[model samples]
Target: MAMDEIIPPPEVDLPRETEDSERIIPSPDVEYLPRQTEDTERKLPSPEVDYLSRQNEDILEQKEEHGKTTELERKEKQLKEERHGEEHERPHEELGQGTKLETQCEEHKRLERQCEELERQRRKLERQGEELKRMKTITIVYEQFRQWIEDKASNSSSGVSFIEFNPSEVDDSVPKDQNHCLGRGGYGIVYKAKLRNETVAMKILNESSRQGEREFKQEIAILKRIRHQNLITLRGACSEKFALMYELLPNGTLEDRLINEKQRESFSWEERVRVATSICTALVFLHNAKPNPIAHGDLKPGNILFDDENICKLSDFGISRLLQQTNDTGTPNHITEVPKGSGPYMDPEFKNTGKLTPQSDVFALGIILLQLVTGQSATGLRKHIVDKLEGKKLEKMDTRKQKMILEKLQILDAQLKLDDTSIQDAVKMVSLGLRCSNSERKRRPSLEIEVWPEIESMNKSECLYGSDEVD
Candidate 1:
């Protein structure tokens, strides 16, 4: 070397980029890529390269013993393992080790939860199986019970397995119509059914064929519970394939006579008053009855029937409910879905709010009294009769209209306005009718001693025993 000359290097230096070239070059040893790629990565050695180098031999030996490829060879071999795990494992590995560990832990927990869920489902299936077995047992028991009852009935009825417990089968020897067909209805068609000579009103429900049987059975149950001279009683029942019989009401129904112009003409004012009084008594009984207080449900003149003694009785308990005095009554505007009685006789309180107070029955009674005295349904009365009576007639009119015309002669005395008749008696009775017709239920007096005493005194003054004839 010359005294002033520097020593030359053994290796050649590579060119470096600068502002002039404005470019970066990659060495042959590395695979270069752009900065951005959602899922691209490059493998790098750990910072502790010396420690890794020392362990490399052991790791290599372990891989070889396990028949796995060396690290350098692994890349080529892994690429060839395309079919089994790479689609899943490669993506996971690219995501970073921290994410992979968390994902793996979550997967382990999910599998464990799945196993627990499967166990719970198996237990639920076992419980359902037991329930099915119990249901099967219950069905068998019910069948056995029915069989036993049928057998007992077969033995008791003189070899006739199903002797209909019907009132219509009174005397099998008589003509079918004359013998009282179980399913009888209306005035002329009514059957005089006999249960051992005790007659019953055998009216088959006439409205809907579907409702006939149900209505008959319901009527029977209602009549059976009631034992009154005033109320048409149900003596016995006979239920068959959509057929029924009731204890016959020999005198027929007030509705039948009232609706008929000629028959209603025979009704006297005295008889009308008597009928009205009897019905009020019946209502009192029903309202005060124990266990389940009834509200006639449908108290139309037609549903009213007379006995041979010319006495009236209230009948018909269908579409009725047992009044349950519950705490819920405190709510001012509560209503039950169930409806009450015939439309006209139905109380206004029952219309707005389903609270059934005794005043409701009183309201209906007031209308009945008016109908009896006027001898016609309120609808057919004089021009603005309701208004003429200070709107009292409208509020007092029963929603139920009589099928027959009212007795015209009953009000003859009042219409005549005889000088001997002070007319005070008629006015007082009419006032009672108006009081019953009050729209506000609370305004109407309950059917207590004070309410009926006024009317009863009038009947006695006319030599009537609560509107009954002295004879």
Candidate 2:
């Protein structure tokens, strides 16, 4: 063989075709792609990665944009969670504030109520303090009265005694006969009784009358301290039975005499004037009483008593009041929320103002004076006199006019026939009565200065006239 043929004939080793090797082979029709440049990376993003070579770039750009979008979404979710947490906490904080405000309002209401209760308690204490002071004054007055009674009993040399009797002894002395009963008053019955072997009058309080017992004690105290010829004399007293023994007056009360036709017929104008003067004197004594001035709250014909000699006396000091001295004017007065007195004789000023003064007694006396002179009912007597005297110039009138005025006044009592002097006296008394009963208290004349002087002058004139006639 030739040398070249001999070399070809020698065995050469060749690689075998496998699956991985077959995959590495490229088709002849496919185009080749190059790596991305820096300038191409900086250019605007393209669709589909600018074809094959741009495909790899497009994939890389998409992965980068997806990463950035995920980061932004995570941050937005975190922000949303924080806002939701704040929204949930806000309502609880507002509820806490509202509860605090309600509690404050309730506390304020409780404080206001407490303040009101304290104010009420303060007022109650003030009222109680006033009551206690009044009771203390009453106790002092009672002690003084008791001491006076004891002193009188110890100093007395007469057979009269101030011993308190038992109820059985008082009852045994009293007569049960209706004929023995002298009179019946608001508080008790007056009866003829035998006490200590002496005939005496007994005033026995009704069992139901608690006020009568107080009045009885008051009467005893007043009688023991005061002595008057015209006043009834207290003989003895039974405290246990609420009974009082007194010297009986046979003539009875002024009311009984005034109402009786026979007695009224015999009651002369001169006698009426005397009676009026006597009552005025008694009132003066009562008004000037020591320690305090007294006001007889009830003054009526029934409370005026007469002796067999026709002498008048005032009685029944049950409703009497002791006036206190005022600091501002040093005038004696009794100031109260309500004033008590008989309606017809009540002082106009005292009724309206609740202040009892000496003028109050003067007003009552005026009514009594008018009743004595005219023998008319006291209810409308003052007004009748006022109406008749309203426009008349009494001081300036002539004698004829004065006579006509007197006729028009209708003040003369139909039961009595009066003389010229008595008629003139009646006119004078009516004038004085009208003056005293003036609605304005300041206009009323003073009893000591004007009333008593006029009465005394009239009495003196009558006595002088009688003396001249006798001579």
For each of the candidates, the C-alpha root-mean-square deviation to the true structure, in angstroms, is 26.6, 19.7
Q: Write the per-residue lDDT of candidate 2 for residues 1-471, one digit (tens) a residue.
A: 222332222343535777666565443222211212333346445555557667778888999998898888998898899888888887888888989999999999999999899989999987777555434333333343345457756876533545566788897988878999988877688898877777777888877654666677777777766655445667778887888887667787777767777888888877888777767666666666677777776777887888777778787766567788888876688887867777788998889999888888889888888888777778989888777778675545555565566666776666767666666677778878888888888899866556765664566323322233222
Q: Which portions of model 2 miss their true places by more than 4 Å?
A: 1-163, 208-210, 336-338, 393-404, 460-471
Question: Residues 1-471, candidate 1, lDDT per residue (tens digit)?
Answer: 222453333454777666756665554333322321212333344457758886897788787866644665677666777645777786667778879788999999999999999999999997787555434333332343345457756887412111245433633523465545432333123555454444454444445443455465555555565454456545444565333344455677777666677767777655665676667656656665556566665566766777777777676555544465556553122246654555667876787766665566787787666666555674433323345544433223332211111112243232322222223334445566667877777677556443454554544323232322221
lDDT of 1: 0.54
- In candidate 1 the C-alpha lDDT for residue 433 amounts to 66
Please report how far candidate 2 places residue 372 from its true position, in Å.
0.5
Q: Tell me the whole-model lDDT of each prediction, alpha carbons only.
A: 0.54, 0.72
As a TM-score, model 2 comes out at 0.60
